[model samples]
Target: MTRPHGRFQQAFAKALFSSTEALDPAMRELATQPAFAVYRNTVMKACIDALEANFPAVARLVGSEWFRAAAALYVSAEAPRDGRLLHYGSGFAEFLRGFEPAAELIYLPGVARLDTLWLEAHAAQDASAADAAWVARRTPEQLAALSLRPHPAARWAWFDDQPVFSIWERNRAQGEVTDELAWQGEGALLTRPYDTVTWQGLTQASCVFLDACAGGATLQQAAERALAVDVKADLAAIFAGLLSAGAFTAPSSSPASNERTP
Candidate 1:
């Protein structure tokens, strides 16, 4: 026979979590237990509140009312599995993809992804600056042979004609219409040291070039890859932009790298 405390605990958990409710007494407790009722409501509220606060951009994109509604359903189905609150909604974009009620908001998932990206970049470890002297140290040939390691804060995104940035800017705008389809394909380079997140529309060539560099291509090789695709593309402009933006760090060491550095 179960003690009164044990029975109450079972009922309390059921009352608190939707999944556990069917596992134990429910209706009887709802009618009879005042403390359990209060506890259950408080826990549920906390979950919804945390989700809303952590993913404010997501809430704004979908609207507070709709996001709150979805949040409640999501929380009930997926009790937080970890202690880290910021990571709670990491999988939410995928959840939004299949969420029936959110089907009308086609780009909601991508927006959610960008929000997640922002949070991740914001949490990345502090890094040293990509000083000009670092690049200047290289000899001409070494500069040409240089390979850059991306910062921990780097975020590379690919979108398919999604107006992810437009919506974000409009919501942040003093007065502007951030229609989703108004913008074309976009990509972003997220950095944390300066605490800046800049989204820029990328040409196909630029994406391929940066991607190769990210994959450890040396400067000469990456530029060759970019030019192969678009013969007239300005490799110098790409290097200048990447360098100005502090897009990466120097390679460890190589003799080929020595020819360009002092």
Candidate 2:
């Protein structure tokens, strides 16, 4: 009942996955062993470097050895689940939250998520940021239906109690911390228009809009949904804010495409 090629394919896959550690003797004897081994090491290194690059603040906080060890273990245990490595580390923050070694850095996961958003936004298609002219082109009814795609660089982050974005900015700019208010819990919106990645502090209602848009709702719907959290929420102002930040994508023609806005 066994097929020869199927068995070889299965064994080959196992070998490819075993690259993070070393090539087992059984795999080492294959004709393409050297190439496969190198490829595996490269994949592992890419993931490690990516984790390091995106979460540089975390690396700075935890130091190199510990970061690399943890990143390596993470990559080894969970290979990337997507073809695009841009947002592959999305789950990494959650992983860190649960990982034991970095237990002391309670906010490290949120920090990592910020870094991941920066990377993803930077990698998004560099369409010209939507202009006021585009906004002017739409009628009120069209505006009502006007869906937005958050700029390729838009990232929505939530924090329970740590003003992580503020801390990141201050440390990144090498500013001395004179106030303890930086630790207060707050969410953030990270956006990049070209080369600059900036994180702005956000309010709960603002976070609600972002999360709603991120859930793939239309602009008007996103606003209405967000306003449900607060009767006085400034829906128009928030939409303008998001547009100015280059957050939003037009509704795509693909009927089956239900991708969540980032």
Candidate 3:
């Protein structure tokens, strides 16, 4: 039932994915076998390299050989849809979740997700850091109604059941993975303030607070939400920390758009 072009495409795709597979019969006479093999190898290498670049922590957790094998399978199963390799591995975290061989590492998917967030933050559109002095100028009433604008390059808290942020930090420092520490749920906020992507771990209350702010809630509402998360939450410290980190842009009349203050 296959049309002529469709049949040729299916065979060509098969040949493209594997060097050992013969070229489509129609094209076999058009190109040399050696040339096809070289092309296949080059394509596979590029895909593996892209995976490695995006998930260096995953590669470090599993040795290069294991990572390479997994990458190969991933590339074959989930080839890039577009020419942009920068966005190539968006589904890799999900891929890792179903990857049977990685079943032992319950944290791998979280790590991959964090890695993707880091990439996104690094590539996000540039925005000026919010001026902390603006807070001093606002009346208490104005402040209550004022919603904080999040930096374009800032990503709100990402919570995971695994201690993904701790693992990522330790791995980045090239520290030894130890069994001595107890792992628990952790959260991360990724931001690119200057040239480097930075992240900080957050508690459940803090994560709730930031998520609320990112959704366009006023500061008072964000604090109320945080208190709902934990009655003893310290709103002042969280506000100060976010301000110091430049997680937010200038205060705006509307949360959806940034407005410059005099």
**Leading candidate by TM-score:** 3
- Top model number, lDDT: 3
* Backbone clash count for every predicted candidate, in the order shown: 7, 9, 0
Full-model lDDT for every candidate: 0.69, 0.71, 0.78
Supply the TM-score for candidate 1: 0.74
Residues 1-262, model 1: lDDT tens digits: 9999998765555556664335545455463577756777788788888788767777877788999899888887777766677777877888899999889877788777777877787777655435556676778798778777666676656676776655554543325554445657665555554567554444556666788888988878888888887788887777666656655553445333344334
Instruction: Give per-residue CA lDDT, model 3, range 1-262, as digits (tens).
Output: 9999998766766666643436555566533567876877898899899989888888888978999999999898787776878777999999999999999998888888888888888888776676667675678887777788777888754544677888877775577667654567887888886678888877777888878888999988988999997899888888777777768875444332363333
Score candidate 1 by lDDT. Answer: 0.69
* lDDT at 128, model 3: 62
Model 1 clash number = 7
> Which portions of model 2 show Cα errors greater than 4 Å?
1-25, 28-47, 80-88, 133-145, 171-176, 214-220, 250-262
lDDT of 2: 0.71
- Model 2, 1-262: lDDT tens per residue? 6698897766665665554346556666762557866877787788888778767777877888999999987886677766666666777888999999878888788777777777777776654455655676678888777665666677777677887877666655655778766567777887775577766777667788877767767667877877897789887777777767756553453221234334
Model 2: colliding residue pairs: 121-153, 148-248, 148-249, 149-248, 149-249, 150-247, 150-248, 151-247, 161-185
